[model samples]
Target chain A: MDAMQIANSIPMWVACGIPVCLIIFQSLLFMSKARQASKDIGLSDDTVKKAIRASAITSIGPSLVILSGMLSLLVTVGGPVGWMRLSLIGSVMFEGIAAGIGTQQVGVTLGADPMTPTALAMAVWTMVLCSIGWVIFATFSASRMEKIQHKITGGSTKRMGIISGAAIVACFSSFVASHLIKANADVGFYFSKNAVAAILGALFMFIMMKISAKHKKLSEWNLTIAMVAAMILTAILPIGA
Target chain B: MNKEQKTEYFENTYMPKMHRYGKLIGVIGVLVSFIPPIVLAVVFKAIPDWGKLPAAFLTGAAAFGFLWIMEPIGYFNILGPVGTYMAFLSGNISNMRVPCSSMAQVSAGVEPGTEEGSLIATIGMAVSVLINVTILTIGVILGTVVLSKLPAGVVGALNYLLPALFGALLMQFGIKDIKYAIGMLLYCCVLYVLIYLGVFSWLPSAANWLPIITAVFGGIAFKLIVDSKKDKAAAAAEKKDE
Candidate 1:
């Protein structure tokens, strides 16, 4: 069979489904355990329910973004593999890059050259092996993170809080900065629609938070409203165009 | 439960159980990841060149190895333990899981570093995972049909979703400390410009990680210095009172 046929085959679907099922199972299991633990620790049911609602609502936009990304993956790698990888341990960019590298190793350029079964196999192998590092590291090192946290903050909860807040701000700022700046091959650097979107997103969120302070119910929808407003404004503007 | 008892339960019972289960599931995930490729080779008789396997592995590893170590460490403080496990396994860490976790904490009115925060973060992450997978499954099955029907502008706007999400999250965290938020944002922009100018060309993959490393550690260092200065001022006030 050809690459696409093999990629969309029943065995392929079943093979890919196993990992996706595992992820769902793990999420459900952890959710149940955490729910029980939250009760034991005296977190209000209202708080837990609100978190669930907020997170679920917040996930929709990004999940749609991932869906768009998956369209590219689907065309190149076929449905089953793309579905499985994205559902499990691969981002859209990483998966595309890894697939390209894999095909390149077998003397082919992904999307540029027609895929052969051998090339597909190489792509799958590279994707899996490339992702293994994160799983293994996180598995072994996750339990030990508290010790590192303790050492960093000198065992003071107050210091720990400060550091944690700083780290979060820094990490996200880095993400925003990267998005805001566009590097062109000919030009050095310039601001683009992404920057506009980010700025607008922050502005909208700030306003939303202010409004939510009084409305209360609006807080749960703050992120969704901010994101949609920013995206719409960025799209309508002709800054980058 | 009282504060001490709650802390004790989280550290002693809940955390330990999560760790054990997380490790087990992680191992299983790693092993299961190879199934599709194995199935391709064995069932479909599609086999890659054996000699090239190592080169391919090395190529991928070289490109992404640093992220494997850096991301887990960088995201740990925000994600906490259980969220980390779910996030790494489920992917979309920065875009989907982190924002969801942060928003959950915000809506729940919990501080990010506390045990209560961690539990809320886990619930947030789990909820996102469930919704994300469900959406993905349905999208995959119907993507071609639905996506083709959508306006090109709408599809194009999807790219901005991530930046918008990041921007919103930055504001979410930044509002707590505006000075650090602006400082870190500027710091990252400078680093990105430096990277674009090839100042860090001597380092491999400098563009990918330099901003992150500097921002994260730099923020931590800045906080430590500020806190120490505050402590010193408090101590001086106490001395004066004495």
Candidate 2:
């Protein structure tokens, strides 16, 4: 069979699925362990369930984005590789660039032509080697990070909370600010749909939090409501255009 | 078990299990990650020549090598230990995992970096993984047929969804302390402005790094300022009491 055939074959799909299965298994294992730990620690089931609900709700938007990215990749590498990679690693940009380089090395462009088996092999090796660093580092040092946080906070849980909160704010502000900065570049009454959507999203969330304070079920849906509201608003407004 | 022993058991007993699972997953993940390509190459007998290997690996690594180390270092605190293991394997740490963990902790009303917060974060991450995998599996199975039928405008709108979620996420955390959120936002804007004006032209790579640079430095500076003010206030109160 040709490169495309192999990439799309059932065997290739199964091979790709092995790691995905491993990921699911590991996540299930960790989830069970965490649930038990939380119980042992006397953590209320209500809180745990709330977290699960909120996280699962919050994930839908981002997962859709990944799905979109996966479809584009499907055109380049066949269905199985794209599905497996996006399902497991879920780094679309890195995988796309790596695959491009693989094709480039063989004097063939990735989407432009059929990939040779040699080109496919190189792509796999490159993507694996480049992305392995995270697993390696996390394996050795994941446990040590709490100590580092401890030292930073001087054993103060309050201070640790502040630091964690600040780090999160800083990290997210960078992305939001980048979009806002670009939106503000026009200097007039002009705004990009992205910036408007972002503002609307935050605004919607703020409102949700206010309502949820009095009526608690709203908290679980805060992320979903905000995201969907912003997306719908962007579609209807024509503000960015 | 009581609180102290629970903490000890978690750290002593649960933590070792986490490490064990982490390493097992990591090793198995690394080995299995190579299967798709390895199997294809073997089936077709399409292994590339040895001479071209180094360049192939280096070319891809060069693009993202920095993030491989920096992401773990940068995000470790937010994710904690168990979250970290799952996040690296699942990917999308910044966009998905961090938000999930933070939201989980906040909703649970637990302070991050504590045992309760760590367990909650791990649970949040694992749920997210399961949800994501389920959706993607369905999408992959039926993606081309379904997605192809959707309007381009609708699909285009989907792109804005992530940015929207990010904005919402910021608000979720920012509501706890509006002052710090505003401060960090302003700092990020300044970095963006400086880069936009070509002030950092000589350091071209700094533009791409503007966010992270701003985050680390801005967070530290802001923390120091806040701490010093607290100290001053405490001292003044003490003197008044004296």
Candidate 3:
């Protein structure tokens, strides 16, 4: 099938929806859990829930907006003749951006070989990457806490989820506007796939953290070990190998 | 927790040993991760089909083995199969194979290896690279699913997630050191300027290094300029008062 036909397939809808649901679910999941955890830890449920929701909402807008922005990315790149070149351009642009930061490190820069193809050969692998990042963020947050100052008022779990979800759809739309109209470039895969997967994987990571917190499954120790092992593997591997 | 209580909690309750153990294992794990590619590159470099298999398989096995071993030793509580699989997937990325020391520098929460934290830094980079690869993989899978549903043009939009995600990830990381963050912002800025100015078509290693080097010194430069100016202004005011 042609590229246009491939873009709007059934599976795509399902994939998109899953992350949407999950993001919505995450606001609720964390709000409730934080509320419950706060109550268990002897903090007031109402207060903790409100604060958590408030903190989370700050991030919701940006996350959703960034994600939705991906939808229209393809249209902006123009028809198929240039998609590969654009994708290539994007690959280098992003890779250079990614590898060039922070320090004079010789890691990713030395190994990165950007693909000028319509698709990154091993590009699908990035979802797992984004997911792992989500995991790290979630796990770290779960384990660490700042003194919760209950300032946000009336931010309930249900309300927060709806607001975040609505905001996400809107933000996502705004971000995707260029792609939607341009009909040339696409958000490509980065917006639709990695962001969704990252949010979902991270939200789901609550289960992992909860279990660990309760001392049932993973402990801090295992996290360290796994972290080290994963670190080692990626170091010697090729870019997106 | 109160300040004292918090300090005590970190000191006693959290177990410093865990972090040290993490660092130690991380170094070894990162070291182990380097093996498959070298081995494969050496022994079976000629085989076409065998090319990806050894790298993929051996790396997967090594990642899992390292994680599994460290999990119990370090008393980690995690998702049983999920963590293993995740690590397995991450351990196998092409980018991770390049021996890039840059991964540690990329992750903010994780410190890069210098003299003090070298081992831990190495471990952290490995993990971060694997995670990046894994997340990218998931994004592509889900993105393609969307692609399959939509027309080809729409499907192409799915590719934008990496930069989007990277942007978000970097933003999150930059929160740690706002001043240092200029380096990243400048990286994008310099690249654009160079490209726009027609200084070069592609970034030479020099183009990349120059901005970052400036940014690195830029931090020190910023502070020095401000301090020196402040000192001069203060001395002038003092002289006038006298």
Candidate 4:
């Protein structure tokens, strides 16, 4: 069968469900363990509940944004593959590029024609194989990281926390700095919408934080608020072209 | 039991169960992850072109291979083992999981790496997975027609959203530790400027990695420097007391 036919096939959908179920099952087990651990550690139930609520609330906006990306993937790879990949190991950005590169290698443009089963196979292979690095590293080395970190910090969780926070800062600074590099090269008022958007996002984040202090519920929505405001700013601003 | 012994027991007894279950399910996930491709190839006799496979794999890997290695090492401290496993498996680590986990930690008033913080982060990540799956599933069921109808300008702006989000996230982190934040920002600026000035242009690949190296290692170095100063001060105080 062709890509479209296979994608819509009941068997493919069922196959997709396997990974989804595994993820859900694993998540549920972990959550329960964490919840029990929380209680054993004398954590107030209210704090745990607030975490669950805030996390869920914060995820909605980003998830919608991801939904748009998933829709685009569906246009190229069809429903089952797109759904499963997005639902499991891949994200909005990763799978599309992987599929595009896979199709390009075989001299077929994704979404340009009906993908033969072979073409579909290529996409699947690329997506699955490309993503294995994350799984492989995590599987073998994940547990070891705690030990390594403990050794590095000389058993100080506080120092480990600082190192972790610093890592995040550094990682994000690099990403933010890349935009500045792009903007620097452009030599225009706002040639890089990314830079503008990033600055605006920071602005919005500050505003949200300021407001959330008084309002409280807004804190839960800080990410969503900043992101949406920045999205609008990027749309209206004369940049990113 | 003392707090240390309790923590040890939790790590020894409870953590092993997490590892067993996580590894078991993770192995199954790895195995099942390949089913779609294998079945597609076997059932349809549509194995990919052997000649094209290497190029295709390399092309895909080239873009993401670094992230696969770096992300786990980078995020492990905050996300911990369970969060690490789930985040990598479910994907969208930087954009979705980190924010949710961090926010959860903040809202719950816990520092990451402690037992309470780790638990909260895990719960937050799991909830995010559920929410992410739910929303994406609905979008899938709704089909592309309605989704594609979203205004061009609005969709165009989505590209900037993640970049912007990252910038905001830096601020969130910066507030907690201004010294490290400033140090990291400076380190990134220096590296990026160096790359732009063509210092690393001789080795183009070096430019690609310099920012992250600056971020991870540079930040660590700054932390060490700051910590040493604090240690010195404490030691001097103790000496004075003596």
Which candidate should be chosen as best, given TM-score against the real structure?
1
CA RMSD of all predictions: 1.4, 2.8, 19.1, 2.6
lDDT by residue (tens digit), candidate 3, B59-114: 33333323323322121111111122222222321112111222222221222211
For every model in order, what is the number of clashing pairs? Answer: 0, 0, 113, 1
Q: How close is candidate 4 to the true structure, as a TM-score?
A: 0.92
Report the number of the highest-DockQ candidate: 1
What TM-score against the true fold does each predicted structure earn?
0.97, 0.92, 0.29, 0.92
Minimum summed lDDT over a 10-residue window in model 2 chain A is located at A182-191
RMSD of 4: 2.6
Residue-wise lDDT of candidate 1 within B78-193, one digit each (tens)?
77778888999999888889889888888898887888888888999999999989998998788566766778898899888889989998998899889889989998998888
**lDDT measured at residue A105 in model 1 versus the true structure, 0 to 100:** 87
- Badly placed stretches (over 4 Å) of model 4 are A183-190, B193-210
Ranking by lDDT: 1, 4, 2, 3
Candidate 3 global lDDT: 0.29
Per-residue CA lDDT of model 2 for A1-241, tens digit only, reads 6776767788888888898899999999999999998998889999999888878887887888888888877777778878777766557667788778776887778878777777777766666777888788876777687676667767665676666667787887877777676624466334567787788889988888888889876777888888889888877886874
Question: What ranges in model 1 sit over 4 Å off?
Answer: none
> Could you give the CAPRI-style class of model 4?
medium
Measured with C-alpha atoms, the lDDT of residue B161 in candidate 3 is 30
Looking at model 4, the pairs that clash are A193-A240
lDDT for A9 (candidate 4): 78
